[model samples]
Target: MESPGRLPYRRLMIYLDRLGYLLGLEGVALLRAFREDGSDRAFVEARIAEIRRLLDTPALAEAGGVTAEPGAVSMAEVYAAWAPHYDAGGNQMIDSEQPVVRSILDGLPVGVALDAACGTGRHTAYLAELGHQVIGIDRSPDMLAHARARLPGASLLEADLHRLPLPDDAVDTVVCALALVHVPDLARALAEFARVLRPGGHLVISDPHLLSAYLAPRKERTSADGRPALVADHHRPLSDYLAAALPLGFQVRRCAEPRRPALPLVAGTRPPESLPPHGAWDIMYWCPEAANAAMENTPVAVVWHFQLS
Candidate 1:
């Protein structure tokens, strides 16, 4: 039997193969590569070569190919494992999202600010530096502990974004950064943001871009009972945001989708023997050329600035 977190090699191989096809590799095109009399001899040869490698590689045949699929853990559970190194590790989504978010924040007049789902008080600290009286709220105690240490003087509460612990028309600015993708629905959290903001108060949000989320593999974790589980990360299309916000009387001030920084093509080298394929950037080892071609310059995150009207 497969171990709880051990994914099948076939699944991993299929994923890479699909990515290769999407990137115009592996004889996917009818006339150029798949046809017997096709002109692109190199393309046909490359696809056959890849197929043989996929079938025979020791790494692909190994017991745990990728982390196990699609199970879910609570936000609290997800952050419990991540809190210690949340800021230590670099995140591409955050890298692309922060500058746009800050640029929007910089233009807005600062006042009382609420940082909803404010993990580690990252933006809360920024809001404070901008002279806003900031209150930070998050659901995960593990993340809140880090936030408390980072902003000793600020009001930090254990709360959910769906039910922010603030009164109507309470603040002039609300910032929720890199948290909405974990939310099952954007409506309730957005409604909460709308409720707490005074008329014309600014709301800034940044989420993992839907395309980025779709392309990335689901994060794997262990459930409390030792079953395979996935960290909850949902892909909400850009239209979903508009539908939710427009109903709540928000006017779009600005929206930005920031592309990931370009990645250099990787050599045909294997990943470290110690790490799982799911380990950060390790899966690229399977088919580095196609991975590079498919992922380079893809949008990593979406940032929005809205004003309650």
Candidate 2:
């Protein structure tokens, strides 16, 4: 057997690994909990309690468990259930795009651009104002409807990002803001992004960091009438995001962590009937600008951008 003095160190290392694993499962479980009933306060509280317990256990120091908390749901289910509310007041999350757009325009050559997951056209209209032909693509018709109304002149297409309708190397810039987290297969989505970008074109992407997923730092909430509300998810790490950009022939131009608003910018211009009593707020945006700029000089941010090889 190992010496008693070394036992604590060995146990501590085991505990740390277990804690990491538990946290990862908790991330997935949290996604499920929100989906089952976004407004289910009891359910969410129970999950929080369970996750806390797991984090506190002594054995967790030796080996972590990756079990889902009771009554957890999937991320896709959560998005689909929240789709209507998302379209109505969800633009608040996209408001983080203001800074992202500013960063991209400051560096990229103005031309045709695509808002890969345009949501409600928050960035679509802004890109148009920048004098670039903008095309917004989303999988939800309701989302596209709101996007179209907001950006009537800009082209809005209802399609999934994994399988885009655009030809390879057709656009000057591609902006994927806050959409990668929901994608089941992040690698596939990044491939699609590479496939559509023109040689030497620019691509900007933003998403929550994996570490942020565990340190939520806020109390979970529910509707007064008890409806499930959605929170953010970070399916992949910063390293994965960077790796996806390479091998597709795109060079890392700028990698910076862009800041986001404290609360999600609520969409005020939606039909009242489809709106939620309280909007989903507090989504983060990452603004990574990659160009064929030879990877030598790139503007980088703290919270949002990550430079790729």
Candidate 3:
């Protein structure tokens, strides 16, 4: 039996095998020019060799070395664990999404602003600085604590996005960043945003791009029973966002898909001995060429600027 905190060896092996397959697919599709003679024969040969190496790798065959958390946990627990380092963590999604969301915010006429699911008050602080009467709402108390410390005078509330505590036409702007993916029904949250927004109000939202989530590492957290678990992440296609918003009288003003910059090849060198092949980046080191080809120029996040019609 596998130990409490470790994923089973068979499961880990399956992950490694899939990684190899991903690399092989990328080589055929995107890295064809790099393959020998750029021929179909060369691509098949390369893939076969890589598959052999993966099947024979001794480290991947062994049991109990993998320490990745398994199973899904609630968002509250996930953010509770993430609250302390959320702002400081080098989150690529935040890095890509923030500037675009802020640029939209900068153009809007500032008034009563609501930062729904405002983890750590990152955007709340910006709205306050922009001279708006800002209200930051988040369900996680731990996250709210950080926001309170960051903006002492800001009205910070612990609430869910499906039901905003504000009255009708309460705010002129609503900024929700990197939080909608956790909610199951996009329409409900968008409806609440519309409810509290005045006519002609703006709603700016940012979500981790659907394509990026396929390659990105899943967030891990400890469950109530102390077992390792994955944080819940729901994927909403771009069309779903539009379907949810348009019916609610939201007009699409602007949309930006910020692409991830290409990364240098790291296939020749092994990953650090101290770091095991658990997460996406670590596993990518096992086949860096494929990782680069698969991820290059992919959109990191989708930012939307919508005005209530």
Candidate 4:
């Protein structure tokens, strides 16, 4: 006779939800008993095994491909065509991460700052409110327009991250959020960031870790109009990103994996001026260069931060 209210039951309920199973009250009580009796691990593992079995079932195997429906527009076209919608969506996402943004900006020195790939100027307005002289840039005029409308006083420029229009060693701090994955050439963009940052400047980059995405279960995948979730061009493995940044003279300062809604934030700084340039090398030399080449032709969004040294 096991008690109905237990931790195992709660764990089981969560597992079932994760597996797309609708559990009744009796099922939940049973799980609770298992948890209270110290059998929670065993029961949870069994549930996971069952889900794996379902994933590999013959009926599911017969479905040749898990392709979403067709006739969907490209990500860039979606952004360009629906700039207002895009801005609204971006603002919504940013609002959810306000705490993280605040944490990143906490105690940061106030001065000239660049919000590279400043989509809809969410972070741009955040930086300006802190009294930093901010300059925001984006490839999409529509996005810039929306950003300008939001932050009327802040300077907005239409430019590419891979080749910024700014002069050498101009900004003291650069903050980029959720923008790097869209860039076609991450290495080139990083190099540009480093070139523009002054000595001892700060660079903060926040994006989803590609390794996490790859490891995440397929069931967690998102869909837009029954289409596979669209990500930016340079989305790549975490290892590739680290290698790209390290060689470019960035010394990682902090790495945070937020729990709520689960996101990865990797913050790093440019090496001191005393350090020699990592030297220019072809980004195409890295793994998946062919894939990157194909994406270079496609329009995508990306953001990054670099401090000149």
Q: Can you write out model 2's per-residue Cα lDDT over 205-271, one digit (the tens) per residue?
A: 7665454344332222332344333333335666776676666665766555543333322222222
Per-prediction TM-score, please? 0.82, 0.55, 0.83, 0.59
True-structure Cα RMSD, model 2: 15.2
Q: Regarding lDDT, does 1 or 4 come out ahead?
A: 1
Pairs of residues at least 3 apart in sequence or in different chains that clash in candidate 3: none
Model 1 lDDT per residue over 1-309, tens place? 245786742233222232332233222332332434533666546556765775576655553333443434577887888899999857777778888998998988979999999998888999899999999999999999999999997899998888888899999999999899878768988999999999999999998887676556544566677855566556788999999999999999999999976565464666456534343456555655545544556788899999999
lDDT score for residue 119 of model 1: 93
Worst 10 residues of 3 by lDDT: 9-18
Number of the predicted model whose TM-score against the real structure is largest: 3
* lDDT, model 3, position 248: 100
Task: Give the residue spans of candidate 4 off by over 4 A.
Answer: 1-74, 86-98, 215-232, 260-309
Per-model CA lDDT versus the true structure: 0.74, 0.55, 0.78, 0.55
Task: State which candidate has the highest lDDT.
Answer: 3
Q: In lDDT terms, how accurate is model 3?
A: 0.78
Which digits, one per residue and each the tens of the lDDT, describe model 4 over residues 93-128? 354344565676766889988899888887889889
State the lDDT at 113 in candidate 4.
89
